[model samples]
Target: MTVPQSELQQIVSALQKSGLTVESVEDGALIQHGESRVALFAEADHQGGVIVRLHLDLDLYVEEDSLPDILMGMNLLNQGLDYGTLNLDPVDTDEEGEDSGVAFAVLGRSVLWLPDLGVAELDRLREHLRRFEAEVTDAMERTLHGSKGLSA
Candidate 1:
């Protein structure tokens, strides 16, 4: 069951509203977001499962003063819907044969697993994702606003 463009747009909008910018690829069927300059691809398979790919730039790294960079990466994977299990692939080269630095970090950076979640679980997952997004957005806002005070 392929995901509808409208639904994808809604999901992307919801993500963007939470402060993360979203970019669409593959005719708006896939979405990429986050501060690491990574693009995550999501597509529904014929068997009704969603395939998610994390494309990372080799040079991306988190600053020491920022929130635990490892946790931030995990949060991105944990943001997936719980209706079905998510399968992740390790860092690999794209079709053009360019290195993507996409490696499986389990709870750290990359992920590949099956959730076997039901409708209720899916709802719960969606809520969790939204809440996480809100928290991140709030923290970012606070940091930005607080920085103004430092300059003053």
Candidate 2:
């Protein structure tokens, strides 16, 4: 179920052709689109399917005191999504602990039948990523500015 090297190459090529700057990693690539950057990798799962993991870091650094409100907002956002999850990522904290900043991110994945996939399949994946990116960006903006719609 692992994606063939050919498919992987196709994925990278498609991204590049779409105007995304891509950097190859071990099994996938890092893609930059406007201010949104994502890392995509394909791997085989135990069920014998290729899973493409799409990860985008929501780099909104908020004050510790605002983390709860932001998390709440993200939870509300997640409840409305068909794909991906918004999460409070712990890796972005500084040594100041609570006095420092907090971070959030969006992660999405989809399974594909490698033999049946082509440019169209890649386009679908890209569309999903684009939607996730927009939602995460808007959610972060709402959280940081204490948008009146968000509840702590």
Candidate 3:
């Protein structure tokens, strides 16, 4: 079962309000805020449960950037993604590609996934995404301000 257009709109609006630049795609939506980019897809399972997948796309401006940072962030994103699933349990998760699933696609950027999440899970995911956006924004502000002071 496909998700209602209204619900999808709510999800998009929630992400946008969280400071992410959102774009609608044929199958789902894309969110980009700060150094992070994410693609989200919503579908229904055989049992009439909704499934949501979040794919993170990380931006690495410098070639010498630490891979560990990227990996760590991805792991955190995955954890956050799973939070959505666990909160909305009683649904089955599609784990065919556990380690390397289409949940995330990194074509020069990092990506992560959150699968088999229902409406409630999506709501929670929206809240979590908003918090993540705020933290990231705050950190960037501090970093920039600190760098300016040091260069002065």
* Best TM-score among the predictions, by candidate number: 2
lDDT, residue 138, model 3: 44
Candidate 1, residues 1-152, lDDT tens digits: the string is 97645434554565565555567776442223334344444445456644443433323233223334444533443465332222233434354544433343221122222142345534543454444434433433453376431110
Using Cα atoms with residue i matched to residue i, what is each candidate's TM-score against the true structure?
0.33, 0.67, 0.40
| TM-score head-to-head 1 vs 3, winner | 3
TM-score of 2: 0.67
Best-to-worst order by TM-score is: 2, 3, 1
Which pairs of residues collide in model 1? 85-115, 91-102, 91-103, 105-110
* Regions more than 4 Å wrong, model 3: 1-10, 13-20, 59-122, 130-152
Model-by-model lDDT, in order?
A: 0.40, 0.65, 0.48
How do all the candidates rank in terms of lDDT, highest first? 2, 3, 1
Tens digit of per-residue lDDT, candidate 2, span 9-104? 777888788887889988788888678777787765556544677777754444556776766766777777565666655555557755555544
Superposed by TM-score, candidate 3 places the C-alpha of residue 2 at a distance from the truth, in angstroms, of 16
lDDT of 3 by residue, 58-151 (tens): 2222121334454454444345432221111122337565463232222222222334344566667776665554544444345336543211
List of clashing residue pairs for candidate 2: none
Higher-ranked by TM-score: 2 or 3: 2
